[model samples]
Target: LQQLRSLGQPPRPVTSTACVPRRSKEVPLCPMEQPGETQDAAALPGPTRWPLLGSLLEILWKGGLKKQHDTLAEYHRKYGKIFRMKLGSFDSVHLGSPCLLEALYRTESAHPQRLEIKPWKAYRDYR
Candidate 1:
């Protein structure tokens, strides 16, 4: 309850990393970085991104974050072995191939902190 209450910041909502205002009529404090030469640097194919919100609005349209697992599977079918997604300002690549997974595991740390595994909840509880 305390953790929930402390997260409230009216002027700009507080995310884990940065403060971002909700998608609204108000002008944003910081503009979304226009992908210039950096855009071409990434070679992965993915979802179309709109300015400011990136692919967030599309996620909402597709059925919000709860259905994201299914959505990603659908994307894998559509985009093939690997694809990219931009959520808010964060860009991530999804790997669907076994070879890609094996390659990643080879290069990972001893106790790799990978994304959203079931063990993460247990680890967090242990911590």
Candidate 2:
């Protein structure tokens, strides 16, 4: 380590008076960008919000599950296959194609371990 230190006093800084060119005369932003483009939260839809309670009112009124049957039925009738539904900040993917069943039913030897448990079991245990 001493032998290496003998070879160098860190290189001297070089100073130049050249002014850096501005890209567009706009405010500079960090190169590390956010995941998605920044947008105003007010412009984004939260829920069919009312005056005071915002989305919580609808959720409380429905006892949690949104009345989503109408939208799903409508999409199936119109799209005839697959469609996406936005439900209280969560997404529900609906697949209408017959191939969807085929894909689920077909099994391979190397298929991953399935954690198949009935949904009612959880509710029963909770109760």
Candidate 3:
């Protein structure tokens, strides 16, 4: 098509950054003034996430679902129990410690439900 022809070929070499930008002038990267004070989520260490696809490629590179546990363990050893990961646009935190799990459990409702059940319900309805 004429439109396709008008749009010239892509660049030969694409430039890229190591990680996403943290555009915060007021807040510090890792604020820890008082003793025993917890650091912000942003302050926690994480693997470099590229734009759009984020850390998906990196995760896949290490190995897919089959090796997820091992990959996470490796990351945990490097970045610690709490580290951030971005899969596409969805940002997630990996909490490997018991204390973190306990904190999350305490904050949940008395009868906690699965967050993702729509697909299962839809499949049952279809059946």
What digit string (tens of lDDT, one per residue) describes model 1 on residues 1-127? 0211122333322232222235432222213322111222155678887777877888888898888778888888998776778888876777786544443343344555546767669999899
The local lDDT score (0 to 100) that residue 37 gets in candidate 3 is 31
Per-residue lDDT of 4-119 in model 3, one digit per residue for the tens?
Answer: 11223321221222221244212211223321234555656788889998788888889886787888899999987778888799777777765445434433444555447597
Q: Which residue segments of model 1 deviate by more than 4 Å?
A: 1-41, 108-127
Off by over 4 Å in 3: 1-36, 107-127
Number of clashing residue pairs in every model? Answer: 0, 0, 0
Q: Compared with the true structure, what per-residue lDDT tens digits does model 2 show for residues 1-127?
A: 0111132233222222122124322111112223222333233323354445444455555554455455445546865454444444543334455443222223212333444557767888899
Task: Name the lDDT of candidate 3.
Answer: 0.58
| Model 1 alpha-carbon miss at residue 36, Å | 28
The lDDT of each candidate is 0.56, 0.37, 0.58
Candidate number of the best lDDT:
3
Cα lDDT over the full model 1: 0.56
Estimate the Cα RMSD of every predicted model relative to the unseen true structure: 16.9, 21.6, 17.7
Better of 1 and 2 by TM-score: 1
Query: Highest TM-score: which candidate?
Result: 3
